[model samples]
Target: METSLETVALFSLKLAYEEEGLSPILRDDLVMGDYQKDVFELLVRRGDVETIQFKLNQCLGLAMDALGGAEKPLGRELRKLSADFGEVRSMEQLNQPLLALKGYLKDIL
Candidate 1:
């Protein structure tokens, strides 16, 4: 779950910030400090679903903007999935939506 969360953040950052001449954002990059696997591990260990979702929402929001927001088809679907993710209220319900978002982000990239 932590890995999936990290992957989603990484993919979202790649979509939001990666450019032709700029360096790509890797998981170990300083920019990822807040969204890194260890950060997520701690969140998971404490069962802090709200903070986890908040972190993911930050990245996903950027990714949605990069995808051209709700006006675009892909962005619309991303919005829907993100809404679904936002609806998750417990750790047990996190995996499905998290994986779905991760997979969508990966596919778009």
Candidate 2:
């Protein structure tokens, strides 16, 4: 299917919040930095995939950190998500792994 950065961003947001239950507290503590939120808004408003990917990686790292020291599998999953997100250069290129990551998150969350 045809997609834009906003499509990906919205999907990521929904998957993260709705599916993964990324509450305000989790966001305040782990993700949702000002820069990351702005980058996400840029993606939605301007379709700037490049800028948001970096921010996404940052949030992923923070989320990983919030998982604490013992959950190796969750940490690995977030790492894989970060790696896969880093590879997205175009809308077409993003679909497979984004969907895969959603499925993975389904199992995890």
Candidate 3:
């Protein structure tokens, strides 16, 4: 089985790509924090508001340890994402999607 950490990382990458389309440079920038400020802009334009919010929570939870140590703007975006989506009434509503992602991550990892 894939670990939750790996699953979340892969999902983040996939979601990022889906929102922004394929761009190696952009992907590299995202991974390196070079494009942190614009990460959500594409998602917003694509009408992926929910996925963006979900991704923010996933990234935050996955990197909480590292985020505490790194001073990257991604951390701030994640915080904003959490605030935007944190009010959802049922986390269980996301369980199915997250589970599917977990399976995919497990397979790849």
Candidate 4:
């Protein structure tokens, strides 16, 4: 779960910030401070699904705009996946949607 969360953050940041001829933001980059694996670990440890969803939503929302907004096909698909994330009601129910969202974001990048 932590890994998936970190992947979502990393890919979202890449979608929003990466550019040609520039160094990409790696896992240990300072920009990942708030969305790091350990942060997700802590949230998971406490069963804080709401906070986890909030954090992921933050990145996904930026990613939506980065993809050219909801009118665009990719952005529309991203919006649908993000809505799935919002439907999670428990930590146990989170894995499937999180993985789906992560996979989509990674593929698009």
Candidate 5:
């Protein structure tokens, strides 16, 4: 079967989150960043919002794991993100996480 755009977008976000975002933070032995701003920024600009929301909802746990693996500002933020996004059932609910991720990414980067 052909891959859906939503799946492709989700995979892209997750992959970039791991490669460009989480990996750097983890490798450096520091834990005060959320990473993935670049990817998310790109996603926000180039990706469909519905797709982004779907991916976020479907793959949120992976992001959570990446962010929650530490005891720092980013980690705290991740906890907050988890709590905030856990109840997301609509695209609008994703606004906070997406914006927050962008903001954190700005600060960290």
Candidate 6:
């Protein structure tokens, strides 16, 4: 699949919102960031589980780097997401939530 940064970023933000149910205050930056759309489009084009997870991990890494690498609560959530995706790498191992996410993205386009 062709990876587009915009898709990946959007997917990451959406996953963050869905997983953590972030309040408006916490979501403002993600929603308004100039790079968000491009990054998300990149990830969507990548389209493989491992690749998507890797892109998310990279995003979290960048966030941590910008924040002086502090151990924030969001880091834990990203770790969990990484692990969950790692476990269900194959389509055969996919669970309801992941499947739902895939379906949701399909509908988005």
Tens-digit lDDT track of model 4 for 1-109: 8999999989998898888799988989888899999999999999999999999888888888899999999999999989998999999999999999889988898
* lDDT of every model, 2 decimals: 0.94, 0.52, 0.45, 0.92, 0.45, 0.46
Q: Candidate 2: where is the Cα deviation over 4 Å?
A: 1-41, 69-71
RMSD of 1: 0.8
Query: Which of 3 and 5 is ahead in TM-score?
Result: 5
lDDT minimum window of 10 residues, candidate 6: 1-10
- lDDT per residue (tens digit) for residues 1-109 in model 5: 0122233234324433646534443322222122233444555566445545555544444544555543766657655755564555554456665555545434443
Better of 3 and 4 by lDDT: 4
lDDT of candidate 1? 0.94
Q: What is the Cα-based lDDT of residue 86 in candidate 2? A: 83
Cα RMSD to the true fold for all candidates: 0.8, 6.3, 14.5, 0.7, 10.1, 8.9
Q: Write the per-residue lDDT of candidate 3 for residues 22-71, one digit (tens) a residue.
A: 55333345463522435544644465646554655655465433444225
TM-score per model over all chains: 0.96, 0.52, 0.30, 0.97, 0.38, 0.36
Clashes of 1: 0
Better of 1 and 3 by TM-score: 1
Tell me the tens digit of each residue's lDDT in model 1 across 52-100. Answer: 9999999999999999998999999999999999999999999999999
How many backbone overlaps does candidate 5 show?
0
Query: Of models 4 and 5, which has the larger lDDT?
Result: 4
**Whose TM-score is higher: candidate 2's or candidate 5's?**
2
Model 2 C-alpha lDDT per residue in residues 13-60, reported as the tens digit of each score: 444455343443333333234444444555645656676666555545
